[model samples]
Target chain A: MTPAFEKLQKQLRQLPGLGFRSAERIALHLLVEKPARLPELVEALQAAAATVRRCPRCGNLAEDGLCAICADERREQGVVCVVEHVPDLVAMERSGAYRGVYHVLHGRLSPIQGVRPEDLNFEALFSRVADGGVRELILALSNDVEGEATCHYLTQHLPAPANGVEVKTTRIGFGLPSGGGVLYADSVTLKSALDGRRHYE
Target chain B: MTPAFEKLQKQLRQLPGLGFRSAERIALHLLVEKPARLPELVEALQAAAATVRRCPRCGNLAEDGLCAICADERREQGVVCVVEHVPDLVAMERSGAYRGVYHVLHGRLSPIQGVRPEDLNFEALFSRVADGGVRELILALSNDVEGEATCHYLTQHLPAPANGVEVKTTRIGFGLPSGGGVLYADSVTLKSALDGRRHYE
Candidate 1:
């Protein structure tokens, strides 16, 4: 291949989930269409890059210094949903059930990757909680290993107000499906089965 | 969803092959990453958009006015590989098989998509062929209905050469595989078989 084609292919592979075939498709689509759509795409990317800033208090992406949830005066100030990323915040919002402000962790703590307690936005969260404005600190992090670790770390740093403020961890309850088999269950799952066993009688 | 979230969903859907789930994943990946990566991605998109351009003659994407193949001194001037898109031309080039210059149609004759004969880069092909420099116009279009129709249209437009140059419609042949069945073939394949039938004692 020519230098230009090779360079394009290399750049295309950098995009998330884009393999050789997808890269080729994108390149060809641009070449064949005279690419009237390209300028707009570029403009969108630049605009998003320039304007999307992290909220100073929450760490969520925002067009301004403060995110929409933080800026909105109507949202309940007493509640805060702690999440690992902006997407999780977005996902919860999509459900249309939650109307509280959010705090984005940016990522979870993984000791294997050398990510310590100081590497995350723990300082921001501590300050947000220290003000004592929020009545509840909901640990809505993922159920994965790192997420569980981050939640444990947060609980330690978050000073429990002897007043009315409650610090709680939220989790999606696990149960057997209507048509699941016990024979195929793994060790961890089998252990949880005995711990939370329910009486059918 | 908020207006911003809705806008993001709409933008994700505009990209090729991105379903709602994939879009959500991409959005999450971008948002969760450090602000550093986002800026780099945005810059790359802008850079590619600004630098990539179409060759005036062959309609291939190039960093300059003319593509490398068109400007190359070693390629065969008497032959031109006609393709529906620059990507197909690149794909062929990547395989290191074709050594001739390429003429991109920009698109095929797809009636359902409102792509007419006049919509392609036909005028450029006609002018190049009429210049009496090319001998063979290889129909390297895809083995699809629209590609066949485009090849037929191009054939009718190409007149007898003014000079000693020979004008012919060349095609890469397709036949039954070395270890394949012929009876399961479609009508088009059957027709090709009959037209090129061999004589046996």
Candidate 2:
């Protein structure tokens, strides 16, 4: 590989979901396989970088002032789903079950990893809640120790109830994934699923 | 996801080895998780685009002029190993076995896929051979129908021997991969390995 190719591969390797082999593949694809696509990708990256911004209300991706969800009048703004990252919010949206707004924490609380409440987008969420725009706070974070810590921190640090605006905090149910089998399910998932079992119809 | 985010994800998905989930993850990572990396990646891409180019001699990646292998005097330039793509050349280099120069065809003969010799870097390779720069040509292409067709095309189209120059053409040995077992080997690989068997010392 040449210097420029190696340099580009190095940068690509640092990107999420890309390792050495993947990076090499991309570099070769861009430089050798499909040279015409290179400029298009660069233009797209530049355009996205120039336009994409965080929505002030929910911290979701936005082209300008607010994200589509926060700007939508029909969405349940008061029922804010707090997620560990934007992808989680996207996942929730993809399910098409939740029409509520989102609060992207960007990351969960991880004391071991030195991530604190102040490091995340907690202040924006707190302000959003404090503005009396939210009534229900659904914690859709991960089912891990860090996720639990983040949920606990969010519930504890919520703005005190005022003007009859009592924010009802809740966590998403943890259970076996759809189409997953109990026989192959991990102990943690099985335990969580059993604990979260609902009444028979 | 916002318009800008979606645009970036669409572009990312078009790249080699990326899929829907990977595109979404990379989009979130770049726009929300680590925004700083986005700009750095953009810079690297621009730099690579501006600097990286096809080697005039071998079609491998080059910064300005000849590729490292083609420019190196120590390498056996007369013994040219032809490959279907740059990645294949990189694989060969990584193997640390062949010290000869390379000629990247960029593609193999695929009639169904409409790929032909004119669509590849065959002219440059033929010219290189015609110039009496090559003495031996090693076909390091894949062991498939298209690869065999490409080998056949190269051998048939090679410039006739002239000026006391007779180019020797050879094909790479096909066998079970290192660390692979006969039980797990595919029938094609097993047959090739058996056909290519050599006497034990």
Candidate 3:
């Protein structure tokens, strides 16, 4: 292998989910098999790097001041879903189950990992809540200990609703996923599913 | 997702073995989680694109005129190992099973895909053989029909040995792989293994 080829392979191996063999394959695919596609990929990467920035209010990917979700007028401003990462927000949107805005915390409360309140996108969320339009806060975080701690922390620190009314806080449910079998469901999920069992027809 | 983010993800999905979800994950990882690594990857891609090229003699990757193996005086240039792709050459080199140089055909004869001899690096290989230093040609192509057709084509088109000596051409043996059990081997491999079986110690 050439020096430049090896260098490219090494850099590719550092990307998420790519191992040595995959990196080498990609390097060869770009350079040898389809060299014409290399310039397009390079341009795309540079364009993304130059333009993509964090959304000011929600911490999702943004090209300008605010994210599309935050800037859109049709989205419900009175409700906001809180999630651990941008992918979680994307997942929620894909489910078509939520019509409100979102606040990406960027990470959850992981005390063992030394992440604190100041380490996340909490201040903008607090300001958004205090600005008085929000009436509900949906905690769509993961069903884990850290997610619980984060929800607890958020509820404890929430400011009074701008209209001097209560801001309803709720967590997303945990249970067997749709199309999931009971045999594969873990113990915690089974417990939650049982505890939160709904009335059947 | 932002326009730039989606564009980047789309470009990533074009790479070998990457699907939509994995491409999205990699885009988020590069742009949001570990952005500091982006510039390095960009530089590596640019550097490889600008410098790496095919070796004139063997068609392997090269920074300049010749690849490392071809440039090395110690490697046996008299015996050339022919493979279908650059990665195949790399795999053979990794195994440390051969000391001879390599000729990368870039692809095999695929009539359905419209690949012809002119579309490959066969002309340079013929020139290398006719120029008179080669003693043997080893075909390490795939075990499929295309590989057999390519071997047959090469043998038919080979120019008379420049030194007026016979050029012994051989195909790599197909059989049970090392550490593979006989029961787990496919029927074709079992048949080949049986056909190529040697006397026991």
Candidate 4:
């Protein structure tokens, strides 16, 4: 293959899921097998780069003013689902369960990884909470130590009783996933499921 | 996500191995998680598209006049390996077993799929054969019906006896791959392995 092809392959190999062989296959596919797709893919990348930006209000993807969710007046803007990333928000949306707006932290506080609070998108969320419009905060972060630390930081720094309106905070339930059996569930999940069990008639 | 992001995801989904969820993850990773890599990927695609082209002589990837393999002087110019694609040629080179050169056909002769000889890169190979320089043509194609048809067509139409060279044609062996056990091989592979068995020491 040509040098440019190899360079492209190397770049592709650095992506999240692509390995060296997968990157090579993709590079060969785009360059040699289907050369016509190269321009289209480049155009798509350029278009997305130029048109997509983070919503200043929610940290979700936006184009002009605000993201679709934040811009939608029908959505319950008062209930903010705090997620670690835009994909997490997308997953919550895909579940068809939540009808609230989102605040993407972009990352959690990971001291081992040298990711501090300043490295996250916490400023806008703090400002949003201070605005007193957010009635509730839903913690939809991962079930990890960093997620717990993030939740702790948020609750500690929250401007509670903003303008005489109490900002209620609730973490999403951590239990056995839907369709997961107790035998398959880990000990931690079993403990969480038992701790968060609801009353059954 | 924005429309442009979704469009990019759709384009990625159409690639060789990526599916809907993987494409979505890639798009989100590029546009959100690691936005810095987006321009790099775009630049790589544009650079590869602008610089890389098929070697008109052998249909291998090339930058300017000829591919590296076609231009190398140390390789055996009299021996040529015919493959269905550039990746196939790369595989041959990776085995450290091929010192000759390659002719990438780009596709096989599959009339059922409307893949005729005209759709493939056969003219350059035929011209090479007609030049009386190729002493042997190794058909390193797949072990499928289309591969057989392609081999038959090549043998039938090759400019043999050109300048009294008596150009020889060969099909690469189809047998149990190296390190592959007979018990794990399919019936067709077992049959081919049995038929092509060599004399034991």
Best by lDDT: 3
Better of 3 and 4 by DockQ: 3
> On residues A155-200, what C-alpha lDDT tens digit does candidate 4 reach at each position?
8887754687878777765584653323234545644643463321
Q: Kindly list the per-residue Cα lDDT of model 3 for residues A130-176, writing each as its tens digit.
A: 88777878776666678778888998888776777667776655574
Q: Which stretches of candidate 1 lie over 4 Å from their true place?
A: A1-9, A70-77, A94-101, A162-201, B1-9, B31-34, B71-75, B94-97, B109-118, B142-149, B172-201
Clashing pairs in 3: none
Q: Ten residues in a row with the worst lDDT in model 1 chain A? A: A172-181
Computed on C-alphas against the true complex, the DockQ of each candidate is 0.31, 0.68, 0.75, 0.73
lDDT of 4 by residue, B42-115 (tens): 99999999999889889999999999998999999898988888887776665555688889898889888899
Error of 4 at B164 (Å): 1.4
- Please give me the DockQ of candidate 3 compared with the native complex: 0.75
Candidate ordering by DockQ (highest first): 3, 4, 2, 1
Lowest-sum lDDT 10-residue window in model 1 chain B: B176-185
Worst 10-residue stretch by lDDT in candidate 2 chain B? B192-201
**lDDT digits (tens) for residues A88-129 of candidate 1:** 676656655566788878777988999888888888888777
* Candidate 4 segments exceeding 4 Å error: A176-201, B161-163, B176-201
> Model 3: how far is B53 from its true place, Å?
0.8
- lDDT string for model 1 (B14-69, tens) is 66767786666555455456446555655555556667777788888777668888
- DockQ score of candidate 1? 0.31
Contacts from the true interface found in each model, as a fraction, amount to 0.21, 0.83, 0.89, 0.88
Better-scoring candidate (TM-score), 2 or 4 = 4
Q: Against the true structure, what is each candidate's TM-score?
A: 0.73, 0.81, 0.84, 0.84
